[model samples]
Target chain A: MKFVLALVALVALAFVPSFAGPYPLGLGIGVLGYGVLATAWAMFSGPTRYISLATVAFFGLGAYTVAVLSETLPYPVVLFVAAVIGLVVALIVGLATLRLAGIYFVIFTFGLTELVRQLVTYYEVNVTRTLGRYVFLPLGPEHIYWQLLALLAATLGMAYWVRQSRIGLALRVIGDDPVVASHLGIRITRTKLTLFSISCVIMTLAGAIQAPRWTYIEPSIVFNPTTSFLVVIMALLGGPNRLFGPLLGAVPLFLLFEWLSANFPNHYSIILGLLFIAIVFVLPNGVLAAGESLWTRLSRREART
Target chain B: MTTISRRTVLQGMGVSALATALSGLPVLAQDRTAIRIGYAISKTGPNAAGAGISTTPNYLLWVDDVNKAGGITLSKLGVTLPIEVTEYDDRSTAEETVRAIERLATQDNVDLILPTWGTGANLASGPTFDRFGYPQLAGTAVTDMAPDLVKRWKHSFWMLGGGHDYAEALVALLVKQRDAGTINNKVAIASVADGFGIDLSKAATPAFTEAGFELVYDKTYPLGTSDFAPVISEVAGLGVDTFVAFSYPPDTFALTQQSVVANFSPKVFYLGVGTAFPIYPGIAGPNHNGVMGIGGIDPDSEALAAYFERHTALNGQAPDNWASAVTYASLEILAQAIERVGDIDREAISAEISSGEFDTIIGKVKLVDNQLRSLWTVGQWQDGKFVGLAHTERAGAREPVVPKPAWVPAA
Candidate 1:
């Protein structure tokens, strides 16, 4: 854990310079963003086992909310405004879909995202044009990097705090056996609702952070299905069930994408796809989870001997 | 994929498009033994229709004309090297495009790289070529942000005008019309939500204001939209006379088709870019008889007709305004750059584009302050043809072609 903390701190420090150069900085910022999103997703899916798929709904709503509100205030204030909007959106979405399980949850969330995207694109709103013309924020280099860092930490910090809390215990119990948890006097529905809302807020914040990076908000990129898939894949491939999983997952995957895109062009997708398939079959418990278990077992055997 | 009749195709291509297709093959390499160039374009996908119509045909004609005139002289090798083109299909995705460029620069290692079709595809591949420092000559992509985008990523350059050209030219065309007493009404703008669409959509304010027309309706939708009923109905409700369509092929087809079905005929319908397709008129039937646009090379011009005749025979399709002319002109600029630089080293060629004078089909073209110097003109659809309607001196026809003043009950 100390090693991981030190590594993360060093990487975060190194990331400030990424904002200085265009190519390196852009890729760095993007990878960091996905890392944050993947981390949030891992907590919900790893222990909760609900397969929450409304990441898009939360992200898109948050993005538009920030863009529309920031027209009149600073991005920080706009983010708070978006959190309020996201809370309402999540409440409606959660109350309707949180009861469903497994595949049902996935499909419902998918449809919800598409609906949100369509509404954003077609529906006309009566909001003032305070954002004026530019949809992007104007910030200096240090400010953007600091904002991004703080946003990332806030998302991670909240997710970690929830995972360690009593509600997290209830979620774990619900994942293992919902009926038993109910028999044990745990209010599963209320717990799931609370978790869903929190999960959505975290995802919304991720979108808020992302909007400034592109400086343009469109229903497509915000509600992008690809983003949902990336987060899920990162979490699952890293150690899914662990706190360090998503960060670990995003590193190798993004590296693979960048390297192949730069060097082999044609073989980029082929290599990434093959690697993903290999990982899925061979590393059932993911890289960190399985590797850690193997090391612990080896040390235990040596102690016994 | 049925064979397009040469005569029928020629009837449309006439002179401008044909000459555009044939006119700009590289003057045999002055120092090297051979000139090898690469083209990265989509050979298959939803947008492939435009690629097939525009870039691919003109490429075949340009290469064929040069090869027929004997092998290209290569200055670097101190001998002329017959032109050899290696074409790769990007599958119309940004990731695929990036990968394709990497292969072109490192493996097949062609001297010149032709621009891919769409903005997103180019955006994906643009950074990779910049990383390796290659001279990329894009034939058809229109985004103002693209120049700044490439400058940030570093090396790749563009030849054909970007999206700013389309919107600015429409404003120029409308301003001319308003001054000439050709139109007296509100302006409506319809753009999509793709790469350059959002930018162009927002561009209506300046353009409409410059032309002195009140912007009545400014609407944007997603790219794959197959129907324009709801939007066109809204535009009709606004009672607009001049409509600016900032759309690509698929949505272009939809908007034009639906506008006709809705009976919402703006007096001067400005289909800025997408309707530049020759197939558009054939697709829209009589509805396309007098639509206005910004495709300078007329389909009926003599030079363009020969291009259609030859291109139809070879590539099995008719040449459209956006697809063939822009792509051909890009290659023309690229070949000329190579000739002037006298070497295949990527740095010198890129510097030449980044630094000097270039005259191509679009006339006296060059990269000024990382944007275009000229090329914001207009074209109009007359009798099922997209004719050059502005920036004359090349087929030289500039004017609007719908709802003549005689037809309007004198406002």
Candidate 2:
């Protein structure tokens, strides 16, 4: 039943570009990108209970990779290279921080993003001797929109698969008790690292696909820490435990951002912050969980009547 | 079997939410008779301070002033059409800036569009503006690639002096001072790492070296840096007699304040962007005396005095001497072009701007090969005002106070 519904949604989204105007198509690209980031982050972090904050590091790496290599290689080839780079970097960071848990892991990942940003900035100044590179892709809004939608669909399908597989059971055990899972013949570090690397590839590919839309890339703009935090907030706000929660959270949140920014540009950030706080307080488990509880309660009342 | 699954419920909610959001978007009304000018300006974010001081008010003032005189008379249509402006705050990011401009062009279908606040924003949106056939008379941009950009995008126009020209004029002034024994031949340079600073620094580095001045120190710092004490100390430690900082507004103020705190004053102190702003003098107090920066205006012109009074009256603040006057002059050019062409067609207006010269508050202005040729390139603060210093061949050119006085501590 769930697979049928997911197929219907994907088919419906695929046709959006045929009828939508430039403004809606542009918004569609951004919203789909955000959806991919949030869902992919939830894929690894939700089951393993490892709150990784390295989305920006991978995103920036992918963007810079395309910026540097897109002139010589085709964009599809650049995306492949970006995924390989993301996988390699993720493995190295995951191995080094495997022992650290909880707050230490969070801090290290946060610091890693800042470290990568500064290093890229230094390299651009000292080695490249240029402020930024201009991208001249000939793709229009409709083409970019379809590409992002395809990426988002792939991310959703992968998330659903990971949630229902044998590795998913192993991850849940590790999240419950790492030492006990290790004793029960589960390769704890290997399982966690594989999931982390897969998530990184998805995120990096999203970044690579979206990079050309910017038309120009600067290190500061590409490697912004704000992107990392926004993805985390979107995933958690939508309900990380479920396959579709991040998607649910991302669509509405990004739409709200677009509306607020267009109407009240000055106070949108403050309003967004307050709204996050409200969500955290009222729906701690997420909006999906809140809706589930509401539906169950109403059904019980209907049965009694 | 009849129960609604969680995934189905979630998909239903997602589709409905998107529908609601899209439906809520305000439809832009299309009035064919009105002269609609659209723009994306930085009302909030890193570039907002500069936009607030220079770009946004000129836009508002121009729109209001035009509408008050019963709009522009279109002899082709035999009717006078009132001007309407639709503005969006870009939040100072390149992505948002481009998105806003695209919305203005495609969604609003504005007949004409105005340029944004800075070099990067203008350059980022240049292709889009060209594709949409809007005449982009960029008011605040300074780039050495102006010729190339104008060539590539035929409808685009740059109104400010190019980076190379500004650099040559500054170097010429310093070389004259060097020959006169007004100061030592040693010079230090630092700039922000953004496009504006990078272009100027790239132009100045070789120009300073070619003029027989010793390049004592050179560095570039990232934008939004609040601490310049260490960099200032390093330059001061090098014992250079002259210092030039190609900076944005925030860093401009920060670098000067830190220099005063570090007591690292040079014989020739020149900063960029914030130097012509009234707030700079207000913050630096008496220390602003003997300081030099880019984009000087004629301080004694009666027309400028009147424009300043009107700006203060309309916006409750004085405009920056550098970019604000050029911005207003660009609007004046646009207004005259529209009136002369007797139509609101983008191609006709662009051709009028390209071929015709017009009188403006900044004196007679002309776009030679899609670039302005008449404007001051440098300014100096003397006796509580920023006076014209370099590029004196233009109108409002004044002799500079050579060998700047030593910096004074605030009382």
| Top TM-score model | 2
Superposed Cα deviation of residue B210, candidate 1 (Å): 6.4
Per-residue lDDT for A39-78 in model 2, tens only? 9999988877778888988988888888899899987898
- Report how far residue B115 has shifted in candidate 1, in Å: 4.2
Q: After superposition, how far is residue B20 of candidate 2 from its true place, in Å?
A: 6.0
Q: How many residue-pair clashes does candidate 1 contain?
A: 42
State what share of the real interface contacts each candidate retains.
Answer: 0.00, 0.24
Candidate 1 per-residue C-alpha lDDT over A104-176 given as tens digits, one digit per residue, 9 for 90 to 100: 9988887888888767665522222111122445653345455556666666676677778998888899989
Q: Write down the worst ten-residue block by lDDT for model 2 chain A.
A: A125-134
State in Å the error of residue B172, model 1.
5.6
Give the per-residue lDDT digits (tens) of candidate 1, residues B1-411: 111332332233244334322322333534434577776677755557767777777888889877887755546556655688877766564434554565566555567677677554555455556667876656565556655666564566654565556676667767767777767658887776554566566565676776567988876666687888888888888876688777777777777777767777778876655677757766776677677765656544565576667777877766776546656656666666676776677788778777777665545666765445445357777765667776522333645665622122211
Q: Per-model i-RMS in Å?
A: 16.8, 5.4
Provide the TM-score for each candidate, comma-separated: 0.69, 0.91
lDDT of 1 at B48: 74
Highest-scoring model, lDDT: 2
